[model samples]
Target: MRAAIANYWWGSSTDNRHIHWMRWGRLTAAKCQGGMGFRNLRHFNVAMLGKQGWRLMSRPESLCARVLKGRYFHDSDFMECTRKKHASHTWRAILAGREVLGQGLIKRIIGDGSLTNIWRDRWLPQHFNGRPITPLADQYVTRVADLITASGQWNEDLVRQVFFLVDAEAILRTPIRGRGDDIWAWELEKHGMYSVRSAYRLLENQRLH
Candidate 1:
């Protein structure tokens, strides 16, 4: 379908063996990059599917998410779920673009911290190395709340025991807001909300690199 659209825009016809004055790849580049601002249909499709996956991850209470989960990923986090054999085409399409959604998604920690897992989540502040502190942190310290006190403050001693010195320091410096639930944020946007524009931009940057 995308190929057909590209061919039509480039003036290719069934009867003529004419030259394509400009190749499809060049013509599809963004305007700022010196081509027609035509959206790459393949990437756009994946990105749109990614937005649905994002909704499933962040809005599990929605009817669509619940139905998918009951059928496909009952025991795993949406991001960690895998496609099973004999799945519907719709399920497969959403799974295909899951990685694009994961890359730009950020989990913000707040309140009780029960939903944020300490060792598994990316909530730790980044260091100079560009990696979160202690990517190899102990698996024993599972939930982020495990490192916090009943009084709603960090448990400094437990954090030191579970994480490396540097990571422990970083964790101690992190604060949890007292009244709200943990939330997911789209790191690409200022308001921390997901947008198709941000998803496309992320996909474009990734393709370039």
Candidate 2:
């Protein structure tokens, strides 16, 4: 398919012979970066597969998501799940796509903060590294819920004391008004939802950089 596409791109439809001015790779680069912006087929496939993996993360309530989770990662989240020796082709393909998710996957703090670890999960949207810059305090907090007050607000005094000033401020700024589960989201999009378009762009940018 690639050969046929390349042939049609630079040569006559009736004949294969033509003067190729640029390589297929350059043609696949972004148009703004001085290339034709053609989609790299392999990268696009991975991005699409990544979308499936992302759905498995974001839509745990869906039938497909639940079934896959039961079969694969019943105890842990998709990101932490490992390969099984008897894993199906579908599972392996989804895992391949999931690999593309990488560090871009971040948890949005929504309802109760039980699922998000205070020291580990990437929940701080404003912070550069996503996780808190605060050093772990001794046994005072483990989950994000520990940092929340009884009124569902941040434990202001504890937050200020336990975290560095920077992290304290970031934590204080995070809104936890919604009564939903803490869920994983793609950090690249404003709505925090994953799309093949965004995934493809992310994959392409990674290739370029």
Candidate 3:
């Protein structure tokens, strides 16, 4: 479709020999990079679908997420769900965008930390290796709440024993609010909000790495 649009825009016709000017790659370059700032169709489609994936991740209790989860990922994380051969087109599209969403998102623990599993949940900052703080983290603490004392402060001694000194220090630094539900955030964004634009940028950046 984009090819057809470009052909029409440049007056390329079957009856006449076509003359090429600028390349499509340059036309699709961002405005700041000195191009036309035209949206890349493939990226735009994935970004639009990724918006739906973000909705599923952020609004797990919403009707759409509930229905989709029941149908697709009832026993697994949405990020871990695989595409089924008989799935609907919408489901497939959403799954495609989920790859982008997963790369740039992280979990944020708040208040009681009751909802997070220390070894299983991604409450810590993502490391370059993308693994938990310690290989034997599950052997140390079962849940994030376990790291908290009865008085609601982090268990510094226990943390230092279970994690590396560096990781233990980082864990101690995570703030605990008096009361609030745990939330997830887009690690790449400053405001902790998910946006298709930010997600799309993440996908482009990932390609370089």
Global CA lDDT computed for model 2: 0.84
Among all candidates shown, the one with the greatest lDDT: 2
Q: What TM-score against the true fold does each predicted structure earn?
A: 0.81, 0.85, 0.79
Q: Model 1 over residues 51-157: C-alpha lDDT tens digits? A: 88888977889999999999999999888888899999999999978767767766677778888866555675444322246656336767787777889988888
Best by TM-score: 2
- Model 2, which residues run further than 4 Å from truth? 12-15, 135-140
Global Cα lDDT for candidate 3: 0.76
Q: In model 1, how large is the Cα lDDT of residue 64?
A: 93
Per-residue lDDT of model 3, residues 69-156, tens digit only: 9999998878778887899998999999876676666667676778776765566665542235677724847778888898888989
lDDT of 1 at 133: 61
Backbone clashes in model 3, listed as residue pairs = none
Q: Looking at model 2, report the run of 10 residues with the lowest lDDT sum.
A: 11-20
Q: After superposition, how far is residue 163 of candidate 2 from its true place, in Å?
A: 2.3
Which parts of model 1 have CA positions greater than 4 angstroms off? Answer: 125-140, 155-175
Q: Tell me which residue pairs clash in candidate 1.
A: none
In candidate 1, position 191 carries an lDDT of: 85
